[model samples]
Target chain A: MNERILELFEETPETYVSGAEISRRLGVSRTAIWKHIEELRAEGYTFEAASRKGYRLISKPAKWQVSKLLNGMKTKALGQKVHIYDEVDSTQTIAHKLVASGAPEGTIVLAERQTAGRGRMGRSWHSPSGKGIWLSLILTPRIPVYFMPQLTLLSAVALCRAIQKVCQVDIGIKWPNDLLIHGKKVSGILLESSGEDERLKYVIAGVGISVNLLEEDYPEELRSIATSLAIESGGKVSREELVQAFLLEFEEMYALYMEKGFAPIRLLWEALSVTLKRPIRTSTPSGFIEGIADSLDDTGALTVITPNGERVKIYSGDIELK
Target chain B: MNERILELFEETPETYVSGAEISRRLGVSRTAIWKHIEELRAEGYTFEAASRKGYRLISKPAKWQVSKLLNGMKTKALGQKVHIYDEVDSTQTIAHKLVASGAPEGTIVLAERQTAGRGRMGRSWHSPSGKGIWLSLILTPRIPVYFMPQLTLLSAVALCRAIQKVCQVDIGIKWPNDLLIHGKKVSGILLESSGEDERLKYVIAGVGISVNLLEEDYPEELRSIATSLAIESGGKVSREELVQAFLLEFEEMYALYMEKGFAPIRLLWEALSVTLKRPIRTSTPSGFIEGIADSLDDTGALTVITPNGERVKIYSGDIELK
Candidate 1:
């Protein structure tokens, strides 16, 4: 009922929708329409109702609603099911619940603002309402857990491609799972999975894109180091469009990685990598090692040749160019 | 509180302590003790309570209860926190819940019987009441998800040693994660993990040992291929003792695998391997490959040399001796 009313409002925004028109479109009686209007009103919807003009939807409470996003989704499995929240603690937290309840691949959990959003190593993510995209995708890839590093990097590439096409800006991916522009962090991906040796049950890839954030949206500490689409492009980019484009690109990359293996994804990632073939240093548990970035191993570890010409496969750590 | 009462029951199995003694030991009044005893009674615990004498525990519904398992567990972590179930759908199901609740490593989820126990490739595992050891161990190994295959094999080796020490029988691991005796299946391991590319959150290694199941216990279908510890040794093996032994062995190997590498475990595994350097055939999704089972790689893949001398790393499949 809410969808029917919202669609009508979306189509005829310039004029008020008549009661008879709503009843005919939704196949409901005038009394049913009135009840729906009352229900929507109770749910924080404003309607300009008059005797002659039926209802004019003033505003919808949920800004980035699921019903709006699912309107033009053309992908196969990706974004086929989207769960939208007005506010959430974190998309990954809800994604975990969906995984526990046997939610399939391409299921998405998105929120307007994350009160306790986290990044890699449990760092706080600065997400504000009507600013950035805080979402997690539930991916069930039939691969060993070791190949997860590739999946993480694959997500970064997908995000980079999606943003590049939409915003027409240059972007590069950091070694493991960060997207940088002008060597400033604009996006970060955290890929958390549940699996076994042979097959992964589910992988929750949480992508935080600075889509529509302004200069003031970023925290005081991150002013110089952080950026967003609005700040870079000086234009209001639709969050839904970016999300749809990312889902399509990720579906293609994920399917290719699963069918033909990680070689293709690795190549694409290397082409856009800001850390590859550069004099770099990685902080590992044993100690920090300064090396030249060589290539990515099949397992997705950064293969670097140290000063002594000894090759080292660094699994995970913060990487910096020397 | 339950543990305290169980300890008291364990100490005085024959004689019933007075109400005053029970209250003093438990730091509770007689009314509190009576309420606890009533709650236990409602939960299928039978106790003989007198006016002056305290509760004499007559029988515990589950013999290998959590309290019994943790009585004298010497390990630092493994099986330190046992979650016992009288009857459950699957230990893996409960283990996932514990992982979500951030249960510490060495936490165990065991059941007397599983109505819906499952094995690899979605096969049904026959778990009967009071007959077999159906338990899942939660290990938080701080390793990449890719190295899970090695952990699966490591678990197989740990089980082999534990069963040998408890039952005094020779056992062999079937390629990836199965235990065999006299060419018949005696145990199986299912290593399920949750994590991302960087570090794994937890690995729920579900070990199902056919300890005391008779030939009749298995249906007509599994009788020919499956055998039990009691069937092979002709003696009833204690499930609690086997669980205790397996936890200890697993903790030791897990520590070594963390401090050292897979080298020592691989050597021990090779010493007891029955499939190594033998002619074998594996059924893979691509096709069947007949080869000489040569050795295991560092990542625990079975390096099989095909008839034409091509090396094939069989990740997962059924194996048959040619």
Candidate 2:
């Protein structure tokens, strides 16, 4: 009944829909219609009521509405089944639990806000309420566990493309996981996996993007190095639209990766990367190495040529451009 | 109290210990000693009773006794905490449950029999009752997930060295996991892991060794290919001694690996491997490839030179010697 009432309101979006008309259209009493309106108002839907003009929907809630998001979704696999949350500790945590219970590939968990969002290397991600796109996508790829880094790079490319297309802002990848705009971090991708033997059982690609966040959303420490699309583009962006675009782009890129291997995705990642082909110092698990960023190897490791004219492949590290 | 009784019996292995003397030494009544002996009998221990001679220890039960196994054990970490069972679906299953409940590294799970033992590629392993060593050792290695195959090779080398030392027989590893004697299978090693991101959480190295099985213990299909240590050595090997030797050798090898790297373990594995430098046909995940088995790469992958003069790294596969 609420959906029907919403549909009637949507038909005449600019004008008020009378309670008697809504009751007649949905075959309910005017009292039921008024009660439904009260319930919708409690859920953050704003209604403009008048003595004779009836109720008009002034605005919808900032919280994610599953029906609204899926109304015109374009992806085949990704985001086909989504679990939306008003708030969560982290989308990745829920994704892990869902995977343990046999969640299918492309299952997505989204949250309007994260109380304890996580970044790479155990850093805390800033996810304000209803201001960004915070999600975890579950993928069960038929590949060896070593090839997991490729998926991380692939996700970066997909997100970069989606943000550019949806928000009309330039975004560049900063090696392994970060997305930057004008040399400021705008997004972070963290890829985690669970498997047995050499085969991968599932991967949780957790992405946190600062889409419509204002300048005050970040902490003082992050204000100097962090940014959001709204702050960069001089206008707020729609989180729902950005999420849909990301899912579509990610689904296409994932299909291409599964079919043609990581060659194309590597090329895309290199093109969008702001860290390659530069003099850099990397702090790897073993130690620090100063070298020129070379290229990505077959296993998605970053190859760096050191000053001694020797090439080294780095698996996991933090890089600083010199 | 049971451990004390066992220690007293060990003091006079070949002679009888009077019940009255045992009661006096332990400060227990004669009735209590009788009840303890009955309980020991129920646990499969055999006792020879004589009215005048008191009691003689005929033989201990074939079931694994934790106290006996831990007595004089020569390992630092491995087998320090052991869970012994008379029957289980598989030791690997129990090890996984233990890991879920925060079981520490070097925890060991042992079973006298596995009704549903598993091998690589979902094959069923033949684990008979009280005739072989079926165990799973839990390891929490601080290494990248890609280096997991090295642990598998390390385990094979450790098991090979231990078996050779304990049973006084020549045992060779076949490429990745199988242990063979006289070109027949005697043991198999299966390594499994669970982790997130690039770090490994834990690895369960499930090893099944046919220790004292006779020819009739194997089914007709496996009789021609499977051989036990007893069948090869013409004597029953002590299960307790073999388990202890394996745990000690594995702990030493694991420490060396964590200290140095896979280079040393690789050399030991190569020395014991019978699969290198031979013409072989490998059925990998991609397909079958006819090649000559070459050296192992740094990641512990078996490299094979194909007919087209291409060196291909075989990650997971079954090999047939040509």
Candidate 3:
């Protein structure tokens, strides 16, 4: 009914229609139409009104709404349930609590702003209101916990595809989980899991994509290393459209991952990988291993050919692309 | 000063010497001895009265005190700082928060009971107060996050060693992280990691050992599957001594893991693994594979020879021994 009222007001934007005509067109009482208008007005909507002329919606706030967001999200499972929050501490925290309470798989939590956003290593993510898409997907995958690293790569590819589709910008996945454009990180993926030994319950992949952050918005340490889609594309992008596209792409890639295993997704990852076939050194607390990158193995472990011509399997650690 | 008091108390059990004599013998003050007595009494000790008679220790409770437990713990870095709690929601929860807050490596959180104790698969662990040892070890390993499966195997071996030393019972590590005695689970491990992509900040291995639960105390559904040291040994074991032994063994294993690799621990795990050299099938979310148990690889993945004579690798999952 509210959507109908919105449509009626949108159809005749510059003119006010009488309550009797709106009631007759939408099959609702004049009281219902007036109530809907009042609700819309309460939701930060501007309406031009008169005594008997009824209401004409002048404008609606430019913020992500559940109806508008899901209306454009065309994904099978991802974005099936979209939750929009005006402000949150962290989307991942909310997603974890939801998953614990048996929230459906593929439910997404998108916040307009985050007060305590997080990055990969417990770092704070600077999420200014209405400037970035802070989203987290609750995924219950039928895969061993060891293959979780691949999901990070897959999500990076999905984000890159979405950015390319929305802003026509070339984004590459930096090894591990950073999305970079022109050697500057535009997004980050923080994947957190809660599970037992045999079964993985759910993984919350919290993604923070900087869509319109200006140069001054970033911290001094992040100025040289981080970027935004607006900075890379020279224009601001729609957060709703990009988030929808990402959900669609992620659903497709995740489906392929479930059906064909990591082979297909690994190929996609390798294609979008900026560190493959390059000289890289992985540093662990023990020491550093300098080697030439070779390829990803079946289990997603990176196989590196060392200076001594020995193959060292790098399961995981900090990878520095040289 | 307290150590000297305890030493003197243990030396003369039934006698109470003058404070002046003790101060002259230990090169301390009567005030120091009085303070030590006050501290010991605060730690659940009953002391006899009178200034002339000094302090005569009547009895001591078996609570896990940091000073008392660390005195006997022979670990290098694993149990240097012991944080004992009468009750906690979950040691893993506190450990994860502590890890994020830069808690030093080798810090241990031991709880008499866990209100929301967790097992391998987020299942409830029956950790009744004064009944079991629920401990979480904060470790900063130099290995990649993928190799975290090794910690499970290492902890299993360490616990088995400690248990076998005291109870003379053989325990087996069921696949990923369960410790079984007489084909019934006596302990479980929950390993959690937090860090950046590739770089592991810390790994918290929360271990729950049912030391002294009677048969009637267990739920009916768990009676057939779970066993405790008291139930198996027909007597209550010292929880403090068990905790000390576990910390000692964990420190030894952790030291070896940091200095060497999983190769040495692999040998120990193979020796204690009940699933090795048997007909076993591991059920993963991807698929279930039945094969003859071969051995664990250097990276802690279980190697199984399938019926078709092909060796398949099982990283982290449930394994059923047939």
Best by lDDT: 2
DockQ of each: 0.41, 0.30, 0.19
Provide interface RMSD per model, one decimal: 1.8, 2.4, 3.3
**Residue B233 of candidate 2: its Cα lDDT?**
91
Deviation of model 1 at B279, angstroms:
4.2
Model 2 misplaced regions, further than 4 Å: A1-61, A86-89, A113-116, A307-310, B1-61, B85-90, B100-102, B113-116, B124-129, B215-221
Mind giving the per-residue lDDT tens digits that candidate 2 earns over B66-184? 77789957998889999999989999999999998999998999998788998886788988777789999999886767777788889999999999998889889987879999889
Sort the predicted structures by DockQ, highest score first. 1, 2, 3
RMSD of each: 12.8, 10.7, 13.8
lDDT of 2 at B69: 89
Off by over 4 Å in 1: A1-62, A65-74, B1-62, B65-72
Best by TM-score: 1
Q: How does the DockQ of candidate 2 come out?
A: 0.30
Better of 1 and 2 by TM-score: 1
lDDT of 2 by residue, A60-152 (tens): 657776776887689988888899998889999999999989889989999987889998877888877777789999998877666777887
Ten contiguous residues with the weakest lDDT in model 2 chain A: A38-47
How would you class the docking of model 1? acceptable
